[model samples]
Target: MKTDADAAPLPMLYRLYTAGAQIASPILDRMARKKLQRAGVSKARLHERAGVASQERPLGKLLWIHAVSVGETLSILDVIKELRQQAPRMTVLLTTTTTTSAELASKRLPEGCIHQFAPLDTPAATKRFLDHWQPDLVTFVESEIWPHQIASVHDAEIPLALINARLSEKSLMSWGKRADLARALFGRFSLVLCQTDPVRDGLRAFVQEPWKVVTSGDLKKSSDPLPVNDLQKARLAQAIAERPFWLASSTHAGEEEAMSAAHKHFVAQHADGLMILLPRHPERGPEIADMLRTEGWRVAMRSKDEAIAPDTQIYLADTLGETGLFYSLSTLVFIGGSFVPVGGHNPYEPAHMGCAILHGPLYANFAQAYADMAEQEASMEVADAAALGQALCALWGDDEVALLQANAKFYIEASRNIRKDVAGHLLALIAP
Candidate 1:
C-alpha cells in the first residue's frame, strides 16, 4: 500500500551514526540508566522476547497500548476503562516512558491490563520487547512514533493504530524535510486517528494514504478527572479552610516566575491569600523554592516538613500525582505552560474540580476545547502576565464564587461522551 514516493532512500546511516554518538556520550548514558532505574520496577513484569516483552499473557488476543508520559498516559485511562467494561477477557498491555506516568497508569489500569516501562528505542531493545509481547494490535497514544518499533510491528503483521495522534508545528517542519522517511514510517499504521484537522493536514504532507488517516477529537477531552481520596481531600480542605487560595498547576520553567509575580500582586490586596504553585516537574521543587526565597518570599515546600504558617504567602507543592488535591482546594486555578512557548497542560482537571480556570494565549495544542470553554465563559484567557494577575485579583474580589463554579460544571457536562466516540471507533477497528 506504500506509494512510490515512499521508497526513496532514507538518512538511515546518518541517523544510526547520530544515535551511536548519543549512546556513546557518558552524560546521556548516566541519564538513561537513572531513567531506567526509576521506570524499570514495573517493566520487569514483562517477559523479554524479540525486541519486545510481555507484561502479562492473558489467554486471548493481546492489545498493546503505549503512551510516553503523564499527559498521554492519563488521556487514555478512560479508553482503557471502557475497553475493560466492554471486553472483560481482553488482555491490555500498557507501556509508559516516565516513572511518574508508569505509577499513575499502574494505579488506574483495570485488573486485566498490565503496565510496563517501554524499552529504550534502540533496535535491539525494541526488538526484544516486541518479541516478548507479540501483540495482535498495537495502539500508540499521541505522537510517540518509534521507527524500529513500528516497523517491527508491521513486519509481524500486527494491526497498528495511532490514537490521539498529533504533530506540532515544530515537529511537522522537522518531518517535512524527510518526507519520504516520514511517509515510510507513518505508512506502517493501519489507522491514524488525529486530534485536529491541522494535525491531519500536517500528517498528510508526509503520508498520502487517505484511507488510513482520519480526525477524532482529542482523547484528553474524554478523560475522566483523576479521583480524589476522601482522607486526602478532607486533610487539604482543613489545611485550606476559609483561606483565599488559587492554584498554579503544571507550571513549566518560565511559568513559575509569572505565577510568583501574580501571586505577589494578589497578596498585596488580600494579605491572607495563599498561592499553591505546582511545578510540572517535581524535581525542580528545591530550585523553585530557592528562587522564591531570593525574592524575600516565605516559600514552604511539600517535601519538607514545613507547616503552612499564617505568614506563609506561597506553598510550593512539589509533589507528584497530587494535582487533584490542589485543584480541589483552589477557588481559581491557572493551568501553566501557556504563558511561555510550551503548549498548555490540561485545563479539564480544574474544570472537573469546580475551580475557575485561567490560562495564557498559546494553547494551540488544545485550542478547540479552550475555545469552547472561553466562548461559554467557563474559562478566562489572559493576554500576558499583567492581565493574568488582574484576572486572578478580579475573581478573588467577586462575591459569587458559585458563578465560576457553575460555569466549570457546565463545561464539563457539555464535554462528556467524547471518549465514547473515540472508543467506539477504536473498538470497530480491533473487532474480531
Candidate 2:
C-alpha cells in the first residue's frame, strides 16, 4: 500500500514548490491576514488563517476535512454525520476558507464535528496546523490542491483522500501542462473519488496509480435536500398564498440586473408576479435593494422584516441559511452565478426541493451534473435576459413546470446510490 509518500522520490517541481513556499511563508501569512480581514474575519480570529487554532484540539483520532466554500462545505455535512455514526469516538475537524461557509458550518455541522478557518498554503502555516491538529486522516473537497498542505499531511503519514473531486476543463488543461507537478500532488492521495467518469479520466493521467482515482458520482446530487425551517416555510407560504412567484437564487453581482429585467418582463403580463431575489452574499442585500429601487421596482427586504406587500414586485431574500425556504416558495428557480462566469451554483438544491430549474450557460464546474439534468429535460438553460424572460414566462405554466419537476425527481432518484458509495469509500479511508 505504499504511496508517493512512501516510495516515490519527490518530483523536481514538488521540491521547488515546497522550498518556495518556505521562503514565501512570511509574505504569504501577511497577505492571508489582509484577505481574511476583508472576508470579515474578526481581529481576534485573524490568526486562524496563519494556522493557529483558536480552540484546543480534541483528544482522539481526528479526521480533518477541508472544504473551501459554502457549496463544498454543504456537500460534506452528511458525510461527516455518516462518519460519526460508524466511528463514535472519532472527532472530525472541518476547515473552510470563507465567512459564509464558516457561518453555515456553525449552524449545520453534525455533532462531534468542529469547524476552523483553514491555514494558508505555505510551509510555515501548514506545519503549524499539522503540528497542532495531528489528524489521523485528512480529506479535501473538490479542487483544493494546496501543495504545501497536502505535502505536509503526506509527510506526517496521514491517509489523505480527495472526495467529490472535480476539475473544470480549464483546470484540467492547466494541470496537464505541468504533469510533474500534478503527479507530485495527485500521487500523494490515497484515493480520489471523482464527481464524474470524465473527471476520473482527466485526473487519472496525472496520478501515479490509476486505482487512486475512481468515479463516485457527484456528492451534491446525493446530499440531503437543503434543510427548511417548517415554521418559516408555513409563515411565508401563508403570506404569498397562490401568488405567481419565481426565485433568482445565489445570484452574483452582474446577474442581478438580468434577473431584474426578466422579472420586469414577467410582470408585464401578470402585474402581481413576484420575484424572490436571493443574492449569493447576504451582505450585499442593501446594495442590491438600492439598485432595484432605482430601477423603479418595489423591493421588500427580508433582512429588514418588510412584508411581501401586494405592491412589492421583488422580495429580497438577503438572509443566510434560508435558501431552502425560498426554494420551497417558488415553482420555477433560476440558479445564478451562471449568467456571469462563476460556473453556477448547485442545481441539486433546487431540484431536491421539486423546483423546475433554470441557469445560464457557464456551468463548467458542474458540467456533468447539468448535462445529466439537461439530458433528462430536468433543467433549462438561458443565455441572457431575453432568453431568461422567455423561459420564465413559458415555465410559469403549470403543465410546463410540472414536467420539468417530474424529470428532476427522476434524475434525483436515479442518483440515489451516490451518497452511499461515497460514504462507504470515505469510511474505508478514515477507518482506524
Candidate maximizing TM-score:
2
Model 2 misplaced regions, further than 4 Å: 1-8, 31-46
Steric clash pairs (candidate 2)? none
Across 43-143, the per-residue lDDT of candidate 2 in tens digits comes to: 87788878998878899889899999987988888888778887888889999988889898988888888889999887778888898998888899999
Alpha-carbon deviation at 190 in model 1, angstroms: 1.6
Candidate 1 lDDT by residue in tens digits, 378-403: 88888877887888788885954568
Residue 36 CA displacement from its true place in model 1, Å: 2.4
What residue runs in model 1 are displaced by over 4 Å at the alpha carbon? 1-56, 120-123, 208-211, 399-404
Alpha-carbon local distance difference test for all models: 0.77, 0.86
Q: What is the C-alpha RMSD of each candidate to the true structure, in Å?
A: 4.0, 2.4
Model 2 vs. true fold: TM:
0.92
Give the C-alpha lDDT of model 2: 0.86
